[model samples]
Target: MPRWGMVIDLEKCTGCQACTAACQMENCRLPGEMWQDVLFYSEGEYPSGKLTWLPRPCMHCENPSCVAVCPTGAAYKAENGAVLIDWERCIGCKYCMIACPYGVRFYAEEKQKTQPDIRDVFPAKGDKVWDPPYKMPEQVQDPKHGVGVQPKNVVSKCTFCYHRTSKAPTGLKDLDPNDPATRKFTPACVVTCAPGARYFGDLDNPESNVRKLIAEKRGTRLLDQTGNRPQVYYLAGEAPVIPETRSVRKPKQSPET
Candidate 1:
């Protein structure tokens, strides 16, 4: 099987949150809990300040800290290199949340982050934790891999759209959104990215677009110090390089002060 992975061309990203929205809708997540986020921050002080953005999804690390910390074996790495959570096995210990350095994992239960608790408003129907007005493809609803609307008390993160990718023909290298042949099978975030900043493919294939971009552009992963060895790579290009998390820059001090 192909070692599935993703490469993001940061130079092309516009931080429009199309990827974020697409992930929410495709995965049927609650409003406050999105699998993707585009963080914005500034560098330098006023006159010289520059605004930059970084879009973060689950890294799907080869040595996932989340997987390592899950006591119940609820979180496990799939053969294709995806870190997936079996909602049925997950006990909502929140160990994965604390283990993740990227702040990507989310556990939403009785405590609602969004006011009025959408869960209580919509209420769950049958096995589903909450019924979303928008219906997702029935095929994508697999709790075993943490797809579809999450069950109560389970930690959830991105699965690289495994439901689609797993069905792709054997030995396939890349799933490019621009490619008509692979467009339907591409990850929702990758497909909805208006600027075409994202690319998903087999990392093991040297001929794949994702691998080629990583090689030519010297792609980098976030939080390298953690030694998780992320499968996701960022081709920063002309965009600001994200070496570490960006803390919001404070304003410059006046001479009078």
Candidate 2:
């Protein structure tokens, strides 16, 4: 059984958000409904401050809390270690959303019906090849598998590109440094990374790059204390840490003299 996983090299990642863009286009997620996010913040104070951008995706934990809390079994881990959501079974109770420690889950909102924009309106060409308006492959539209064309009022998250990965031969090990078909099976975010900071493969395979990188780079998991045992590993001097939740406060205005 292949246990898929990812290794993110923080040092090499510039956080340009290419991965986020690729995921959106591949999954057809709406604006602001990013399956992956690049979080940026400053470290230190004053002139010595430094900026860091961290890429975040689903952890696909070995002991996923989302799966544990799901009321209708919408959240489940696949045979290859992908944490998937069966949109058909999802009841929009938000239990898995609350249980996810990584904050990767999202509840899809109902899109308002609207007419095409003036600029987008075009005359009917009568089935022209390479038309301006083309239908992109909708991954979330599969109701049975819940892989593409995400429906409204359902919780959705990353699936490690299950549609692609599930096609890989059982004997296959490394996703990268392998056959073209195997490479095509990896998540879009993994291959789209320009800096090669993201790696995906079977973590259980000794020869896999994911395992090799984690071992050689001293990779670590986030919030391991939570006992979720996330499969995603970070290889860097320090893994990105999510700050404790705090109430937002408005900036104080200067008093008039």
- Residues 129-185, candidate 1, lDDT per residue (tens digit)? 798888577766888988888887788999888888877888789988888988888
TM-score of 1: 0.92
* lDDT score for residue 76 of model 1: 96
Candidate 2: residue pairs that collide:
139-148, 139-149, 140-148, 140-149, 141-148, 141-149
lDDT of 2 by residue, 182-226 (tens): 777878898788988888888889988788888888888877888
Question: In candidate 1, which residue pairs clash?
Answer: none
Model 1, runs deviating above 4 Å: 246-257
Candidate 1: lDDT over CA atoms? 0.85
TM of each candidate vs. truth: 0.92, 0.81
Model 1: which ten-residue window has the lowest total lDDT? Answer: 248-257
What is the C-alpha local distance difference test score of candidate 2?
Answer: 0.75
